[model samples]
Target: MKKKCISGLVMLLCVMLVSTSVLFAAGSKESGASNEVDKIKSRGVLNVGVKVDVPGFGYKDISTGANVGFETDLARQIAKVILGDASKVSFTPVTAKTRGPLLDTGELDIVIATFTVTEERKLSYEFSTIYYTDAVSLLVKKSGGYKSLKDLDGKTIGVAQSATTKAVLETEAKNQGITLKFSEYASYPELKVALDSGRIDSFSVDRAILMGYVEDSSEILPDKYSPQEYGAAMKKGNLALLSVVNSTIADLDASGELLAMKAKWGLDK
Candidate 1:
């Protein structure tokens, strides 16, 4: 009977150990499953990366000292959905080259600055559903006699650094049996300055963004190539925030609010 009692106590201890392990694992999972949404909510603000130079997308208004435009408004919408207030957002200016690294370092919560989505980029970051679509085009001085991509055969085309424009133009140039040289600038304004100063024969970027840079001396060519899809981007593994962002975009799109917003900014075209 004493031996039987010892076995019973040992079995009880064994069962307790197993149960404790199961409980610990459950607790660990619950802790590990914590999402970024909770953090953003705690912070009470949505930090977004945007462009300050691209006029209709996300730019600082000189007269009003306000960050205004389509993408800026989009960030506000996300802020409203997440924080219950449209004004609870802070905008950080980002360029094509810096946005990704900033995201990696956790400096920005979301990027809404005309961030083009690609398969390769998807590997490094989480992108929301395509919010806008555009075709890559060329902007050149009107006096350059540039009617299409064919005109700048051996000349240099200026593109924003870390943008998809160069690859896009190269593919089209190859298809048209043309060899083109490319100069990469850090910002659209610099590219525009380069074009204006005869440093580059053309300024190339998405048509919508290029529209913001067009000057009296420059004209966007009639040729369009490679449809670019813009989406809000976040850090890799940020599934929680991504889901909310995607849902917000879907809800706004369904309500036709986004279409109207685009129209308000003359982007409905």
Candidate 2:
């Protein structure tokens, strides 16, 4: 009888020990997550990924050596909304190919680069409400007289490989019966330089990007450019974070803070 009682006590102790261990493990996980949150909150900093090469939108200022552009200002605004200090943001320059992986691996908290919103991208990353809208525009030399996609038949048109813009352009070109000789590159820098050097007849990208180049260039084509909308990118399933971002965007829109900021950055033009 004493042996039975001893065994029963041992079993109860074992069960209690197991329960305590499990509780500790779960508590540790929660604690770790809470610590991460607190770290971000305490520092009032948000790490945002942005494009470095795109001029007038995400370029480094030649004089001050600071990142200045429309998207940069927008990122700063987002940081101010979440962290209470627009200057608290740390910028991480990422290319189009690296943005998704960096955000996926937790290297970037938000992507405020020239990211376009699309149905296919909705499957992977979460996008904040559209902030700026433009269309996909084709830039050609003034001498080329390439007015539309229909004019690009058998001509080399530069585009970025793996870019959503490329796919959209290709689809539209196909639908419109425009046959283009695609010259693919990994980054916009390559494509733009190629276009400027007359390596390709034209290049297709966001209208804002083309305008940035046109504004800085001495001689650009007299052709009409198109436009597209840009959105902030974030990790999927981050409903709380996305909600906060969306709310902030709404407030900015309603208060005309967005327009004011745009004007400040010359994006309102």
Candidate 3:
């Protein structure tokens, strides 16, 4: 009888150990599956990286002192989806040079700052469905009389550093057999200043961003050198988070909210 009791206790201990192992495995799977989305929901705030200077896309309005633009609208919509309130968002101003690194290090939950999706960028980060499409264009002083890309041959173009604009422009120039000079700035505001001050003959970037800065004295050239598709960016392998963003985009598209946003921001189509 003593031997039988001992054997029963040993079996009970084994069962308990197996049960604990299964529970731990289940808990880990749940945690891993919902890591990013669960964290954001728990925080009650969605942290978005956006541009404060680029007009119509993601600009901080001076009168209201609030971030306002097409991308801003999308970010707020995302906040509404994730947190059940559109106001629960913190917009972190990020430039072309900093946006990717910030997203990589978890400083930003999403980047909607006119982020262009490209094969090269895809290696480092994943992007949601294309939310908006833009084209690379030239913004020149009205007096410059630059009517065509060929006319700008040998002229200096100001572009945002670390942006795809530079590469796109270079490729276009080479394909057209036009020799050009490029001056790189860290931000769109700097490029605007350079173009305004006559330091650079033209400012090259996405037409969506250039439209925000165009004044009566400046005009965008008619030619679109390259096409750009803007998408929301996040760290790679976050399919849960990516799915959420994609669904938000799809909802916006289906509800015509995306087109409404573009109209509000003066984006063409």
Candidate 4:
């Protein structure tokens, strides 16, 4: 009877051990999730992806080497609201081809470059409500006498390869029954050079970008171009992040910060 009692006690201890292990495992998972939440709350830093080249929309100032433009300013503002330190932002230069992949890989917390919102893009990413509005516009040398998109027919137009501009132009051309020779450049700077040297008669982008470039460069403005607005892009299912972004943007717009930013950036007519 003593031996039997010993065996029963041993079994009870084994059961208790297994039960305790299971409880600990469940607790660990909850703890991990809680830790993730805590990390975000504590870190207070936002990793942002922005274009290092697109002037007035996203670009590094040549003199200051500081990131400036509408998107850059907006990114700083969003970071201020979310992280409480606009200066706590880490900006990574993202090109059109790499922005999506970088965001998907979790390398970027947000992308605030001049990314356009589209239904197809929505499948992979979310977009805040239209933060800025824009229509396609042109950049022409003062001596070129080109005033609008209509002036580019049959002319070699410089465009950043793999951009929305080419398609927008093609669609507009088709609708207007016109033809244009497209000269593709790998980057915006190259396209700008091509336009200045007369290798292409015009360069196109959202009007705001064109105007910003013109405002800063005598080689490029009033006689050179015009602008429009574009929306902010974010990752899909990142509803928490998107919510914060939308709120910040709405606040900026309602308070006139958005309009004021554009005006300060030379996008004002």
Which candidate comes out best when scored by TM-score?
1
Pick the lDDT winner: 1
**Residue lDDT tens for model 1, 1-269:** 99999999999999999999999987765554345778888998898999999978988999998999999999999999889999999899999999999999988999999999999999999999999999999999999898989989999999999999999999999999999999999998899889989999999999998888887888999888988999999988787788889999999999999998899888988
Per-residue lDDT over 1-269 for candidate 2, one digit per residue giving the tens place of the 0 to 100 score: 99999999999999999999999998886676455445667867888899887876788887998888878888887778777888988999988788999999987878988888888888999899999886677777766766666777778878776666666666777777877777788777787789878898887777667766663342333433334567898887655567667888899899998888778666776
lDDT of each: 0.91, 0.77, 0.90, 0.74
Q: What is the lDDT of residue 169 in candidate 2?
A: 66
Model 2 clash pairs are 134-227, 134-228, 135-227, 135-228
Cα-based TM-score, every candidate: 0.89, 0.79, 0.88, 0.75
lDDT (tens digit, per residue) of candidate 4 on 53-87: 87667888789988887788998998888667788
Candidate 3 C-alpha lDDT tens digits along 162-248? 899888988989999999998999988888899989999999998878888899999999989667999999988777788889999
Q: Rank the candidates by TM-score, best first.
A: 1, 3, 2, 4
Candidate 2: list runs displaced more than 4 Å.
1-39, 215-227
**Pairs clashing within candidate 1:** none
Off by over 4 Å in 3: 1-33
Say which prediction, candidate 3 or candidate 4, comes out ahead on TM-score.
3
